[model samples]
Target: LFVAGPILLVELYPARVEFAFYRMSLCTKLGGLCETDCLTFKEKTGSCRADLTPLCCRKGKKH
Candidate 1:
């Protein structure tokens, strides 16, 4: 049983890591930072597209 647990975890690990990257890719592609707040210098709060969570995007100030 213990050996089986290790094997299962190893098999599932790559898929879990890949899913994380896929989720982050969408947020990044939309030019958004997945942060709790958008409070920063030269940053504005905006919505993100194709994101699973409620993403607080920090957008740069337009010149």
Candidate 2:
């Protein structure tokens, strides 16, 4: 038999929008590209879809 542990919900979300904002902000100060998908990201909160980007994936846990 196989055993499974408790599953978290946050792990399902991706951080694309958040990353874009952070990255863009930093890049702007450094005279880099301030790229951001305002249209799509505006509809999303802190976390986006998990299947989208792996960088924003969280286990609903605070690190």
Candidate 3:
């Protein structure tokens, strides 16, 4: 049931929409970290950046 449930859920959504949803969800969770010194420093000074992290401001948009 657990395995099938996830597979079925993934199949239910279009690939692009599903990937966007996942990215948005991840961004929301990571957005809270923006207040931390590391993220804040990079945001303000534009240095010491982490390439993998998405900007909190870019929450959503049409592709």
Per residue, candidate 2 scores C-alpha lDDT tens digits across 5-57 of: 22333432345556556654554454333223334322222332223331232
Global lDDT of each candidate: 0.62, 0.36, 0.45
The TM-score of predicted model 2 comes to 0.29
How do the residues 1-63 of candidate 1 rate in per-residue lDDT, one tens digit apiece? 989999999999888667666755766776767665565653634444323544547567667
Candidate 3, clashing residue pairs?
none
Q: Please give the range of 10 consecutive residues that has the lowest summed lDDT in model 1.
A: 42-51
User: Which residue runs of candidate 1 sit more than 4 Å off their true CA positions?
Assistant: 35-56, 60-63
What root-mean-square deviation over C-alphas does model 3 reach? 11.5
| TM-score rank order | 1, 3, 2
lDDT of 2 at 44: 20
Quote model 1's TM-score: 0.55
TM-score of 3: 0.32
Error of 3 at 10 (Å): 14
* 50: Cα error in model 1, Å: 16
Q: Encode model 3's per-residue lDDT on 1-63: one tens digit a residue.
A: 989999988887676566655655665565533222433233322211233443333223235
Query: By lDDT, is 1 or 3 better?
Result: 1
- TM-score per candidate: 0.55, 0.29, 0.32
Off by over 4 Å in 2: 1-14, 35-63
